[model samples]
Target: MRIGILTSGGDCPGLNAVIRGAVLNGIKSHDFSFVGFRDGWRGVKEGDIFELPRHQVRGIAKQGGTILGTSRTNPFDGENGGPERIQATLDRLGVDAVIAIGGEGTLAGAKRLTDAGLKIVGVPKTIDNDLDATDYTFGFDTANQIAVEAIDRLRTTGESHHRCMVAEVMGRDVGWIALHAGMASGAHAILIPEVPTSMEQIFGWVREAHDRGRAPLVVVSEGFVPEGADAAFSSRGVDSFGRPRLGGIGEVLAPLIEENTGIETRATVLGHIQRGGVPTAFDRVLATRLGMAAVESVAARQWGTMVSLHGTQIHRVPLRAALDNLKRVPAERYAEARILFG
Candidate 1:
């Protein structure tokens, strides 16, 4: 069987591990020939691909990012869009199945292709850990660990300068990254997009920390916004794909907290830093498991299904379950962090 693979959406730490695991396992066990798409769905539509073999995947487990590359190209737009072109390309290449590794947008496009009669298997990939149905995605642990280290480093500077530090991490609608990292780093306050915060409440936390003679460390997700506030703080504008350009939330929150509480404040946007670098051992293992399971899905001819991490093992779930709703930070989890907030 000729199988095609592509990585899409934002880059993450464990992407290459997934690709490597799939290629090695699939070739050894299933004897499936593989082709790697150059960039997400665009590669599928344009038939931009390279032959993948076991030798090509050697020594990539610890690497970050996808060797096949990625992009946010939404194939659902305009006439002669991705679905039609993808079908044509598959026919031309004689590929029997596709393995899509990406976040929500990528899965949605793959689902559409499946509905249009293509055999597709998905592997969830996101630093945010927001995809439903999966207990945890590949890069979330690594990204959170990276964010925790950044906050730990900032703590020393914040204490020395007697300033309130606001560190922004990644998350669009979910706060999994902020919540986990904040808890790990002992942040004084953690903010997320799931819970809209007011300027008054924020200042209160900073003031309380200041009164205690300790610099306040606030961790926020890039998608976090103040209630009744403009969205530009989190996004520059819409892209060609119509999704907001998410970044700069810490900058916006920093000044507001300073003005409200009269405490010296700073903001550190850990933008792409969280997505780059070597993945944690945890991430490498999980990504490898997901990739191997994804190959099994192909061998089993399971279309419109994705490999998911459920507790101790990798499980196969319907694509609709993974993409139906974002798995957000639950109230209980947020409340646990709230217990330590100043």
Candidate 2:
């Protein structure tokens, strides 16, 4: 059988690893030929593709980003889009099935195509770890490690300058990255989207840390909003998915903390750095396993399903399960982390 693969949405650390895993497993175990779609759904809609052989995937497991490239293009929007056109393109290319590796938006599109009788499988890929059906996703571990390291460095500089440091990490709708990184890096305070915090509370933490002869280190998710705010801070517009582009919350918090507590403060937005570079060992293994399972799902003709990590094992579930609800940080978990706050 011949299969097509594409990686979509924002690029993540373990994307190349997933491609390598699928191509190698499908070729070796299933004797399947592979083709790659370039730049996510746009490639599928426009019929842009290239051949994938064993050698093309060799030595890419540790690499960051994706070999097939990616984009935010919605598959249902455009002149030559939707299931009918996509199916025709697949038939013309002689592809039997598709394995889409990406976050929520990409998988939703795959589900729609599958509902229209297309043969497609999904592999969950997100650094936010927000998909509800899986215990964890591949890129989250790598992104967490990157955020922790950056926060650790920021702590030292903050101590040297006797200033309060605020580090912003990426978390659009969930706070997994900020929660884990802040805890690991010994941050005095952690602000997340799940819990709205008042400026008085944040200023109290900063002042308390300073009174103890310590430089206050604050870690915040990009989606965090102050208690009285109408919404998360977002200067940039929405993406193709119609979701608001979230950021600059840490910048908004920095000045407030300095002004309220009379402490010098600086803000550092980690930005895309968390999405780049080699993936961690944990992410590499998880991504590889998910990719391999995706090929197996294709072999089984499991349309509209996605490979997910439940506990220590890989399993397949309906794509709708993953899209049902976003896995959010529980209040108990946030409370446990809050116990260590200044």
Candidate 3:
């Protein structure tokens, strides 16, 4: 059988491991031929692809990012015939199934393609770890570890200069990264997009920390917005996939916090750094498991389903189920994180 694979949305650690795992297993065990889509959905739409073989995937397990490349191109954003075009491209390539690895937008696009009679299997890939079906995505643990280490380094610098340090990590409309890393590093304050905190309340937290003679370390997700502060930072621009760009909240919030409180402040946007570099051992194992499960799902003809990590086993979940609601940091989880707050 012939299969296709593509990675989409933001680049994350362990992507290459997933590609390698799927190709290696499919080729060795099932004698399946695989082709990779270049630059995400655009590659599928434009017919840009390359063959995947065992030798091509050698020694890529520890590597970060993806060999298949990725993009934010949403085929359905403008054209009505996008699905038809995709079908034509599949026919030309003679692929029997497609394995799509990405976050929400990519899965949504996959769902549309499946409805249009394409055989698609999904594997969740979000640095935020916000997909509900899986307990965790491959990249989330790596990102959280990176952020925690950064916070640990920033703590010493913040204490030496007696300043408030705000470290920004990626999370759009969810706070899984922020909550986990903050709890892990014992951050003074953890801010997320789910619960908007007032500047006055935030100032009080900072001041209280200052009074206790502790240098404050605040971990804020890039998607976090201050309460009633939409006038300052509006989501108005389109990304490559036509999704609204969600960033810059940390830079905006830092200045506001510094001005409100008398504490000297600095903002460090972790940005793409957390998504790059070698995958941790944990990520490597999880990604390999997910990849093997995805291949099995294809073999079983489980279209419109995603391979998810539930407890110790990789389970199959409906694609729509994972995309229906974002797995935001719940109130209880936030409360646990708050216990570590200064």
For candidate 2, the 10 contiguous residues with the lowest summed lDDT are: 238-247
TM-score of 3: 0.95
Query: Which candidate number maximizes lDDT?
Result: 2
Candidate achieving the largest TM-score: 2
How would you encode candidate 2's per-residue C-alpha lDDT over 246-332 as one tens digit per residue?
Answer: 889889999989998999999999999999999999999999999899999998889899999999999999999999999999999
Error of 1 at 341 (Å): 0.6
Question: Each candidate's lDDT (Cα)?
Answer: 0.89, 0.94, 0.87
List the candidates ranked by TM-score, beginning with the highest. Answer: 2, 1, 3
* Candidate 1 residue lDDT tens string, 213-247: 99999999888878787663634777667778888
Candidate 2 TM-score, C-alpha based: 0.99
The residue-by-residue lDDT of candidate 3 on 231-325, one tens digit each, is 22435696675556776776776787799988899888898889998989999999998988899999999999999998988999999999889
Model 1 TM-score (2 dp):
0.97
RMSD of 1: 1.4
- Could you tell me the lDDT of residue 233 within candidate 1? 62
TM for every model, in the order presented, reads 0.97, 0.99, 0.95
